[model samples]
Target: SSAITKSTKIVLNLESLGSLPADEAGPLARYASTIQAQRHDYNGKVLSIRTEDLKSLAIIYDMSPDELTTRLIEWGVLSPGADGSIYTDED
Candidate 1:
């Protein structure tokens, strides 16, 4: 038998946030502050935050994490990773 576990972190690209129009990133940055997400900046400028933190963010938008992910994708803020993970903060 194999154990299936969900990922505990959400990886985002810091540069993507920077590329967002102020009108868009402004509110997101504000809401993000509320979550007080613990950020881990990597060499690639990726920001990895706890999944729970993203869930908290989703709740603020009245959405599930999956829905939020879809929305992010629509906004060009997230994309599907090579491994089939729909988790990336990039255009």
Candidate 2:
């Protein structure tokens, strides 16, 4: 028998956040910061994010909403979508 452990993989292109438009990048970053690595529970991630945190993170990291989307889809982290959104199915 084989052990099948489960964990989620998230990729944020922390380089292009500045290069892209806020309207576009903002939402994605809003989505990314929700995946914070924490110091409490086994995985202290939240189910959602806030608008302010996304803005702050974008100002600090090199994340780009456009590039991040393509890469995440390629890496199988996100599912490309309509309505200008990407998705992850983590359990």
Quick one: best lDDT, which candidate?
1
lDDT of 1 by residue, 3-35 (tens): 111653466655676677877566665654444
CA lDDT, every model vs. true structure: 0.59, 0.42
TM of each candidate vs. truth: 0.61, 0.33
Model 1, 76: alpha-carbon shift in Å?
3.0
Candidate 2 yields a Cα-based lDDT of 0.42
Off by over 4 Å in 1: 1-5, 31-44, 82-84, 89-91
Give me the displacement of residue 72 in model 2, in angstroms: 1.0
Error of 1 at 75 (Å): 2.6
Q: RMSD of each candidate? A: 5.3, 12.5
Pairs in steric clash, model 2: 13-63, 14-62, 14-63, 15-62, 15-63, 16-62, 16-63, 16-64, 17-63, 17-64
Model 2 steric clash total? 10
